[model samples]
Target: MKAASYDAYAPDNSRLRVGDVPDPRVGPGQVLVEVRAAGVNPVDWKVMAGGLDPIVEAVFPVIPGWDVAGVVAAVGVDTPEFEPGDEVISYARMPIIRHGTFAELVAVPAEFLARRPVALDWAAAGGLPLTGLTALRLLNRLEVTAGDVLLVYGAAGGVGSIAVQLGRERGARVIGTASPRNHDFVRGLGAEPVAYGEGQADRVRDLAPGGVTAVADCVGGQLDTTLAVLAFGGRHASIADPSVTEHGGSSVWTRPDGAALTELAALADQGVLTVEVSRTFPLEEVAAAFDASRTGHTRGKIILTP
Candidate 1:
């Protein structure tokens, strides 16, 4: 199996290489997924750049992607939730300490594997897990509903894109923030698009009129703007900041839940939700995929096709 990995935190690329490796072997409470595709998340670069530990402790020489989607090539002992050849998608644990889906195989704790919707292809299913889980958690925090006015920051980005659709599915009058280029795209996802940047707060204010009952800030370094766009004391959550009006530390981040992943998969199967992956790169280009994730303004998810 070909795999790409980095050891120690330094700005050198020599250690990041694509090469053959023994297939992943499952242990009790774990399952081996024959990798088809993996999602390149911001956390991937954060781990490589020595920045991901704050969420969860990091392990060295790490296989660093957080999203996985593939077939269950082998099931761990005593695991009854899945079987061989099961099509699955999952948000691997934060910090994602073990080998990930960047190779031809990954060993995952069964708790992380969620059934992939049969209607979605491997790439589309792979594009989901992490972003969908994040979106589900954020929207849950926002308490979004049809009667509410929902505001989504970074609407064209991965999690934001899913939030737009999911928030709409929850019946909220969705107002999504995006650049002029993504306005039509955001609108097509069933949300009103508010151009982001400069006077983005004013744009949200105009779109939502009186106020926004809930807001999901997917953008970092823009908390002030996000807060300003929210209705007074209205529900607001951010996957990046994790800090609120009075809280501190990283305790506020949304905790991953397999149940939530299941709900998201149901949504995908039902056509009530969707996620877009902008590009797919192979394991050989792991470094470049991280570069793309770090670029900060992509329209959808970036995937690793192993």
Candidate 2:
């Protein structure tokens, strides 16, 4: 099977290569997905550069992807939940980074697989899992609810865009932070947009003078702005910054839950949620895709179709 792999931790992505790797083998309680599309994430590149070396060990020649949407080519023994031809999507991260989604095939635990939303095309579906799940978890952690004013940092990017919509769906008044160029885009996601950087807190105050009741920081380094605009006794959480914990906010991480993803899929089908895919690359162009992800300015997801 063809895959994109790295021989070692190379910050420049110089070791990245595309070639045939051994086909992933299915094990009991797992399903083999014939890859259709994979999502490129910042963590994918970070892992490639050994940024996560202390936490997660990587085998050399590691295939570099975690989000996938594809069809079940085969089911492992004892995997009664899925059969061949079932379309599915998953956050396919393993404790050990070896087999991954940036390949012709990947083996996923059955508990981590959810039926792909029919409302989304391959690229959108592929991009939905990780970011969507992260957004859901953050909102849940902050206990966002009707009558609460929610502020989402990085509102035009993958996780933030979904967080904006989900906050709106939960009946919160959402305020999102983005660049001047993305203000309209963020507004279209049902949030009032405030440009990030200097004076961002003032801008948010102008929108919600009572102060925001919740903050979901998708992009890090906004602890000051978040603290400034937060209402008295308000909740805050950050996926990118663990330092938030020291300031009375939670540092959040997403868990792989097929049930939660199934609910998100239903939201997509009901027109309450949508994924924005900025661009896509072929399997062989994984390097270019990673470079695009590193730009930190893309409006939505960069995907790879295998």
Candidate 3:
């Protein structure tokens, strides 16, 4: 099996290389996916540099990726939920990082696999899992509902874009923060766009004078602005900033749930949700893909095809 792997930690892409590795073994309650596309995320490189050291330990020569869309090649015992040739997508993060989606094949737990949405191509499906799940979790935690005013930070980025759409679908008036260049893009996602930075709080106040009912922070380090703009008794959560907890906000993290992924797929098939793919790279160009993700300016997803 060919994969992009690194022997040890390096903050940059200097250690990433494409090469042949031993094939993964299918264990009970697992399924083997023939990799078609893998999504590049900030966490991939961050994990390579020991960003998740305190939470999840990495094994040496790690293959870096979590989001995958592909066809099942085989199924392990007790895994009647999937069969060979079934197209699937998964946020395949495990406690250990030895095996990953950035390979010719990855063995994912059966509970992590969901049928891919018919509406999305391989690239879009590949990019949907992690970010979509993150947004879904954030919105769920915030209890966003009809008549609510929701503010999403980093609205044009992968998770933020999905959050904006989901918020709108739930009948909330969504206000999204992005750069001037992405204001139109954010608006297209069904959110009012406000440029983030100095005076961002004032800008959001102009849209929702009573303060937003909910805040979902996809980009971090804006706790002060979030506090300033959130309505009294409002709910708030941050995926990147834990300091939000001290200010009566929650720190949220995404988890793998095949059932939730299936619901997301249904939304896509119904034309209520869609993924935006910014770029696609070949397996050999993993380094370049990571470089693009590091820019932190991508409007949507950066994907890698195997």
Error of 3 at 97 (Å): 1.4
For candidate 1, the per-residue lDDT at 155 reads 91
Of 1 and 2, which scores higher on TM-score? 2
lDDT of 2 at 15: 94
Better of 1 and 2 by lDDT: 2
Residue runs of model 1 more than 4 Å from their true location after superposition: 11-14, 94-96, 247-254
lDDT of 1 at 54: 64
Tens-digit lDDT track of model 3 for 182-225: 98888889999999989999999999999999999999998999
Task: Write model 1 residue lDDT over 67-151, tens digit each, in one string.
Answer: 8889899988999999998898888764456576688888888888789987778888888887887888788766677799988
Tell me the TM-score of each prediction against the true structure.
0.93, 0.99, 0.99
The candidate that achieves the highest lDDT relative to the unseen native structure:
3
Residue 152, model 3: Cα distance from true site in angstroms: 0.3
User: lDDT (CA) for every model shown?
Assistant: 0.79, 0.94, 0.95
Estimate candidate 2's alpha-carbon lDDT, on a 0 to 1 scale: 0.94
